[model samples]
Target: MRHGKQTPEPHEHGGDEGGVLVRGARRYEWSAAVGMLGRRRQVYDGLVALSGVRPGDRVLDIGCGTGYLTRRVARAVGPGGTVVGIDPSPSVIGYAATRAPANCTFQVAGAQALPHADAAFDAVVSSLAIHHLPADDRVTALREMRRVLRPGGRLLVADFSARPRHLRLVNLFGGMTRHARQHHPMADLADLVGRAGFAPTGSGDRWPSLHYVQARRPLEDVSAGAEASRP
Candidate 1:
């Protein structure tokens, strides 16, 4: 439905305001050089199946590197619905823009400070982006995702497994773990989402490394003990 204007370059979000491990533009360039090895399709199917994305749902994809998953989401949501992908890199958005269908748009934005208003989306999905953020930023980003969801909306995050033993050999190499140093273990990620006000639903790994977790905002405001106090 609504499309954001195309940006040629990523707007500077400033230096390591909480130690952002990966800068957007740099990451985009690197990804372009290396190429995505089925990551987009793999994560798209996993996230879609896990989130139960349906027709007419307004979805948001955070860190949508090149709109691969965003395009998939748009297809799932159909013409009646809309999908928006946000990434820190304008170059990534530019690539995404060319391939994006009419129902989807790509914007340059960070997870910690989403550009949308509260309760703007029906479902929020993030893949392989949280670990790139600093310890505190991860929590803040999660909270921001929750804030932008309507009541009972779901959030799904897929990323590398934090458990050292579970990682693939490539992930264990030098400096590969730099951004991932602060990656939350499955349990920790669940707890962090719970603390951010979502009710953790489930978590699991996709074989060797990638881990996915799902959580949902409560339909009723339970933070004030109102729901718990109810008989």
Candidate 2:
């Protein structure tokens, strides 16, 4: 989630500040109380639809936690396709690896320093996790997403656009949603994606708990031509 502002006080997940809530909220016992709100399903289904994932395509899931969505994407992409799920947290990444399918792989890495070749993937996606970074890191991560995506590849990022409460609930419920700081930086996200060479053509549904932003990379720079304009 590219929240427009770059410097959030860093909503700590699993009780670690100065760090993007590394472990998702599910790490806590109370997460189930919060999850029944249908947030997970909304996010899971939304990303699947936004990515338009098909068989035989390479997909990258950044900040993947518990491999919940990663496993699903792996199945959707099928045999010929490959799915790579990356996250910086060892605890969560370890959990993700156990669920890895034959076509899916897991890695422990940071969004700003992705360990992949340029133009190596067909799609790059993240869910409910981007807001934990400082604004500058947010931009760097977007560029990394594009650098790893093949030309014409798609990107789907979903974040918490709004929360009923801010910092208080963030430390309390950060497991269920890392970017739970109540405030959203959607505008900054738009700018970061634009600068990272993406064209954001759609805004996802805004519910009381979440908001999503979707964009795609162009086949060519068309930096100064009408041929590049999106309808």
Candidate 3:
């Protein structure tokens, strides 16, 4: 990874809520903070597995702060696959780009307004990002995710949950952390996914402090006969 290099300044993006931005040294500090939570590698790897991404799948990572999970996903996708990560802060995008693998790319964008075309990705994943969005934009972001995914594509959204009050207390220690706490429960997430036209497949909590919802875009009906056959 490149180091001691000057990075670009932060830029604005289109979204209902601008959300929190972690820039410059704060990015490194946030990385260190997440590490303190313990089992950082394993936790992130579990998210990649839960995403159900194949070797050649195209993946999109929304609100990919510092590209930590993006890099992990790059490994899962291998050399053939590509992972594009978007965040509103250009500084973090620059930071992530410097450390990005060949198969990974970073962009300045927002969760509610992705820059990709329709059905552009095979899998879409976001971690600890849903809470960062405004309450009004959360469902819009989920719909945007669904719009970018191909038919039958998988989606994994992991974020802090309402349970585990101690973890919420930990977030109060820092301004950045404060905004990262649970804004909604897993049921809310399921509701948003369903509203976005995705079929919910699973939901659960992981070790440490994370709740994830797995879903998929419904496949298009190939024919009227096929549609009628379904009970």
lDDT of 1 by residue, 125-169 (tens): 887666656666667777778878888888888776655453333
Clashes of 2: 10
Candidate 3 lDDT, 1-231, residue by residue in tens: 334655534422223346544335454446445533766788899999999998989999988878889999999999999999998876667777888999999998988767788888999999877766777787778878887888888999987665555556666566555333433354477777777678899999886557889998889712322222233
Q: Estimate the TM-score for candidate 3.
A: 0.80
For model 2 the TM-score comes to 0.75
Candidate 2: tens digits of C-alpha lDDT, residues 142-198: 777877777678888776655445344545644444334323545456666787778
Better lDDT candidate (2, 3):
3
Supply the global lDDT for candidate 2: 0.65
Quality of model 1 by C-alpha lDDT = 0.68
Instruction: State how far residue 200 of model 1 sits from its true place (Å).
Output: 1.1
What TM-score goes with each of the models?
0.73, 0.75, 0.80
Worst 10 residues of 3 by lDDT: 221-230
Question: Between 1 and 3, whose lDDT is larger?
Answer: 3
lDDT of each: 0.68, 0.65, 0.74
lDDT of 2 at 111: 81
